[model samples]
Target: MANTPLIQTQGLTRNYPGVVALDHVDMDVKAGEVHVLFGENGAGKSTLISLLAGANTPSEGSILVEGKPVSFNSVSDAQAAGIFTVFQEFSLIPTMTVAENMFLGREPGIGPFTNHAEMRRKARALIDQLGFDVPVTAPVAQLSRAQQQMVEIAKAFHGTPKVLILDEPTASLTDREVDHLFKTILKLREQGVAIIYISHRIHEFERIADRVTVLRDGAYVGTTAMDDTDEATLVEMMAGRAIKDIYPEIPHNPAEVLLEIDRLTSRGVRGATLAARRGEVLGMAGLVGSGKSRIFRAVMGLQPTRGGTVTWKGSDITNAPTRDVIGAGIYYLSPDRKSEGLDLAKSSWQNLNIDLMMGREARGAMIRPRALRTTAAGILETVELRESYRPKAVAQLSGGNQQKVLFAKSFGHDADLYIFDEPTVGVDMGTRAALYRLISDIAAAGKAVIVISSDLPEVLNLSHRVLVMAEGRVTAELTGDDRTEDNVLRNFFNETGETV
Candidate 1:
C-alpha cells in the first residue's frame, strides 16, 4: 500500500490574546497506525486536537485530509470528512440508552420509521467488537466509567470514521478496561483506521502506540517511533527538563481524631461509617459506583442523607447545608473539576473568589473587584500558578494547572476538613507530585484530609491510612504503611479474608 497520510497538519497555529496555543505545529497520522500525542499539562496537545476536531479553528496554517486541504468549520464538517473525536468529558446523554447514544445523529430508519431494534442490533455488534458486555438498552448514566468510555468508543466506531481521535480516554478506566481498549485499538489499526491517542500516561505509549509525537510550549518537538524511545527520554522531551521522583515520602505521627462518622447513609451510600484524625491523610479507594464519593458528598451536604450521624469536633452535623459546613471549616472538591469545581468560561479571579464571596467574609451583594483580585492573586501565588499566569481563563489552563487552581480555591478557604475526589486525574507526574506535596501540607497543618481515588498507588502513597469500599459498603480499613496496590485490590474484592 502506498503511504498516503489520512490526516496531516502543516504549521497549525491557534492564538489567543496572550497565549499562542499551537505554534506552527505539524502532525500526521497514516492509515492502519496508532499515533500518540505526548505532552505535559499546558503543552498544547489539547489545543491541537481541538483544532483537528473542529472545536476550534486555527488562526494560521493548514490541514490536509487525503492530500486535499480543507477548513473544518464545525464538528459536522469534520464528521462528514470521516474524522471522529472522543473527549475525556463524555458526550453521552444520561437519559438516553446506550444504543441511542451510539447512533445518535445518524439513527437507522426504515422508510421514515425509526428502527430501534436495528439500532440495538448494530450497537450490540459494535460493543461486542470492542469486547464490552454492556446491554444496548441500558441508560448510560447507570453504567460505570469504563462502560461509559466503551460506549464513547462504540459511538466513534459507529461513525465509520477513517481517522479517530481519543483525548485522555483511559483517564477513568480500570486496568482491565484499559486492556480491552488496547485490544480494540489494535483491531482498529488492523482495519486501516488511523488512531490519534492523547494521554499523559507515559507507559501507555510504549505499550500500544506505533509512533509518538511530542509537543511542548505550543510547538512540535519531534515524532519518534515508540521502539526508539524510553519513558525518561519522553518525559524530558515533554517537560523540557529532567524530572526526578516526584512523590515525596509521606510523614508519620498521626494525632487525635479530627472528624468521625458514626453511621452515614444516603441515596448513593448505604450505611457507611468512617473516621479521619488530625495530621493524617485518609484515602477511600473503591471501584466505580462503589459509594466512595457519596460518603464525601454526604459529608459536604451536597447530597441528601437518609440516616446518619456526622460528628465534627464532637457536634452533630448530619444533613447540614454547605454554608454551615463551610462555616464549620469543612470543604469538598469534586472529581469533575471543569463542571463542579470551576466556572471555566469565567476569569481566574472570579473562580478563586466565588467561594470566599459566598461566605460571610464578602458580605455585600456586589463584590469588591480589587479585593477579590488581591485575594485570588495570593491564592494563585501560594499554589505556584500566579507567577506563570494570572487573569487568564481557568478553562484555558492545562489539566494539571486547572487542578492546581481547584486546590488553590480550597486552600484559600482554609477549611478544617478537606475532601478531594480523584485529585490528580489526567495530570502528569511532575504536577501530581506537586499536588501530593500540597495535600500533605494541608494534613501537616493540623487539618483532616480525605482523598477518594481509584488510583491505588496515589491512595497508598499519600494517605496515613487507607479505607477500601465495595458494593456500597466499607469493606476494610488498612494502615497506609502496609498498603500497596496489590493489597488494596485484594481487599476490594470478595473471597479475600480481610479486616475492617
Candidate 2:
C-alpha cells in the first residue's frame, strides 16, 4: 500500500436538526489499503461515510480527493469523481433484472436504443469474473438476500473506482459467501483500490483490514494497525471502557415446559419439533434460510401451518390468531426491526407503552403524556436507555438505543415466553452486552427465552441446551459436552434433519 492518500477529510462535520451526528473528524484512505471503520451504532460511522459518498452534505469542513478539495452535491458527482459506495440496504430496483440493474443509468446502446443482448453479455461476464452464483436474467425481487448482496457488489465495479465504500457487506451472507467476498476484497486491494469497510463483526478485521479507525459518540478516538491491536484492546477502544465479560454467568434451573411445537410446518420450514422450558435459554443455530425463524412465525400465525400442533401450557393453540397468541403471553421480536418490530414514526415512550396503551383495561381511558413517560422511564432504565431519549422519535435514536427500546417492549407487558429472533443483529458489542444481561435476567426469573442467531459463538456461549435446525427441522439437540462447534455445525449439513 502507498503512503500517499487517495481521499482525505479535513475536519468533516455533519449536523441534524437537534443533534451533531458527526463532530469535526479527520481521516484518510490511502491507495491499496483496507481501512476499517470501527465504532458503536451511533458513533457517526454511517454519517461520515454518507457525507463522503455525497449522499449527504457536511455542515462544516471539506473533503479532499487526490489532495484537491472538491465539493460534491450529489451521489452522481461523487461517482464521477471515482467514488462508489454500497450501503447496507439494497439499492437495486425490485422489478428490474440483474443485468438491467447492473447497468441502470449507463446502458449500452446502438444509436438511441438499448442493446439488451450486449448488456446481458457484459453482465454475465462480470458476474462470472466475480465468481458469484447469480443469474443475470433473474429479477432482483426473486433472488435471496445473499444473491442481492452479490449484485450490489458487482454493480459497484461498473467503473474503475478509486475509493469503494462497503457497509456491513457480509451481514446477510453465508460462510462460503463471506469467504468469496474476502477474496474479492483482497484482489481489489492488490489492484490499488482504496477501500473503506464498515462492519461490527470483529473476527473479520484481522483477515481484511490493514488499519482501523475507532470512533465513539460521534468523535474521533484513534487509528492503529491491525497487527498491533488485539480483540480486547480494540473492543475497549471502540467501547471506551474495558468490558471484563460480554456474557453474564447465570445458572440454569429447569421449570415446567412453557412451549411445545409438535411437527410444526410452515413456509421455508420442514416438520419442526421443539420444546421450551420456563427457566432455560434455548439457542437455535442455523445458516440463513435454515428455517429456524419460520417455525415460530408459524406458531404465532404470521405464517400458515400446514399440519402441526402448537401447545402452550398444554393447551392446543395451533393456528391461533396473532393477538390471541400475544394474549396468551408470548413476545416475538422480529429480525427486521425497522419494518416490523417498531413504528419508527412514533416516540420511544409511546412505542415502549404501546402494549399497555392498547390493553383491555386502558382501552377507553385517557393517557397523560407526562405520566406515561414517567412509567416508561422505569422500564427503559433496566435496558440502559436514557430518559432524554424517551420523548424523541425512535427513528432519531441510534440503532442500539432503538433495539433497547424494542427489548423494553417485552417488559411493558410481562410474558411467559420471550422469543428473540436475531436479537443482536446490528448493534455493537457494548449494546450486545446490555441485551445479553437482560436475557440472563429474564431466564433467571423463570421465563422461557429462545435466542435464534446465525453467530456460532452467541449460540454456543449463551444457551443451556442448543437445538440445531436444518432445512426447517430439529436435526440435533446438544447439551453438556456435545455443544462443541464441531458437533453442532456438523449437523447443519444433515439433509434429513435427523442426527446421524
Candidate 3:
C-alpha cells in the first residue's frame, strides 16, 4: 500500500446554527505532496481545516487516515494520530514564554519534574531552524506580530506530524521568512508528510502547491494540478466571476494641500516631510519596520512626535490626541485589525458606531439606542455588509467581512482626511476589489486619502502620487512617469543595499 493516500475525506459536511459551512465535500492528500485549498472568505476553507485538525466535529463525513477510518474527538486525539494545524487566527497563550507555548501540553519531563533546560534547547533549535530570531524565554505578548506567527509555526512543527494543515501561514511573514518556511515545507515533504495548505494569495500556489482544490459557497468545485491550472482559472473558480480590474483609476485632480508634515520625527521615524492633498490618493510604500507606519501613527497622535510640525487646514495639530484629531474630521485605519481597528468580542452594530457615541459631541447629548442602531445599519449597508451579519460578533465573521466592518465604521465618521494602513491584508480578491473601489470613491469625493501597503502593485495602481520610505526616512517621491514598481524598488533598496 505504498501508493495509499495519507488522508482522505468523503462527503464531509459541517453546519452551524443557521449556516451550512461545508456541504458534501470530498478531498484527499497523497504522501509527500502539498495539497492546497483555494477559496474566498466564508467559502468553507476554515471549516474543513477545523474538522481535519479536530478543533470541530464534522456533522456528516468519513475521514480515513492511511486507509483506516479514524475519529478525532479532540485536538489531543488528532495530535496522537500525527496531525497538526496552524490556523489563521493564532492560538498561542500571550502570557506564556515562547518555549512554554511551543511545548505547552507536551513539555519534556523526567519522572514527575519538567525538563526546562531541554524544553528551551528544543525551542531554540526549532527557532534557529526556521531562521527566526525570537528569544525562547520572552513572553509571546512581548514579540512582534511576525515573531508571534513564527512561534505558532514552530509550535505546530514541535512533533513530527504525518499531516500538517496550514491556513494562511504566510499572512504575517515577510519574503525572507516565507522563503525559510518554504524550505522547511520542502524538507517535510521529503519525509513523506502530507501538507494541507490554505491561502488566498494566488502567487504562492505555483511556488509551493503540487495540487489545488477549489471550493465555493461551502461546496466542492474541482481539483487540478498546479501546473495545469493558471491564475485566471483559479480566480474564476474561487470568485465564480471575472474580476477585470481590482484597482480603480486614480483621479487626476488634486486640490490644495490638506495635511502637510514638515521634518516630522517620532520614535520609529526619522526626519520625514510629506503632503496630502484633497481629491488625491497618496500611496506609501516600504518594507516592514521601514517607518512607513510611524509617519501615520505620528499624524494620528498615536505616537509622540519628537520634533515636527503637522499643519491641517493651516492649523497646527501636532501632538494632539487621537480623539481630537478624529473629531476634527481626520481618521486613521490601523493595520492590525483584530487589536486596533475593531473589537472582536463586540457585535457589528456596536463597533460600527462606537467612535461617534464616545466622541466629544455626544458627551452631553441624550442617548438614543434606536437611532444609533438605525445609523449603524445605514453605515453597514454603505459598506455592503450583509444585513444578517450586523448583529453577530465581529469575531464570528470572516476576515473579509471584519474588514468591511472596519471600513463601515470609518465611513460613518464622514472624515475629510483618511489614512488606511494595509487596508486589505488577509482578505480575499473580491473583498480587495471592493475596498479599492471604496478608497477611490473617498478620494473622488474631495477627501484626502493616504494608503500604506506592502503590495507594490497595489501602491502603483491606486496612487496619484507615491512616497517611498527606507530606514525611517522618505527616500523618493514618484509621480507621472516615475510612478512604477521598478522605480519604487530602486528607492526602497537604496538604503538596504539589496537589488530588486
Lowest lDDT block of 10, candidate 3: 358-367
TM-score (C-alpha) between model 2 and the true structure: 0.88
Q: Is candidate 1 or candidate 3 better by TM-score?
A: 3
lDDT of each: 0.83, 0.88, 0.88
Off by over 4 Å in 3: 1-4, 358-370, 496-500
Poorly placed runs, candidate 1 (over 4 Å): 1-6, 9-12, 15-18, 54-77, 88-152, 171-180, 202-207, 224-233, 241-245, 249-253, 263-273, 304-309, 359-373, 386-398, 473-481, 495-498
Give the top-scoring candidate (TM-score): 3
How good is model 3 by TM-score?
Answer: 0.93
Ranking by TM-score: 3, 2, 1
How big is the positional error of residue 420 in model 3, measured in Å on the Cα after superposition? Answer: 0.7
- How many angstroms is residue 439 displaced in model 1 relative to the true structure, after the best TM-score fit? 1.7
Clashes (backbone N, CA, C under 3 Å), per candidate, total 1, 0, 0
Model 3 clash count equals 0
lDDT of 3 by residue, 158-182 (tens): 9889999998999889888999999
Error of 2 at 432 (Å): 1.3
Q: Write one digit per residue (lDDT tens) for candidate 2, span 136-161.
A: 99999999877998999889877779
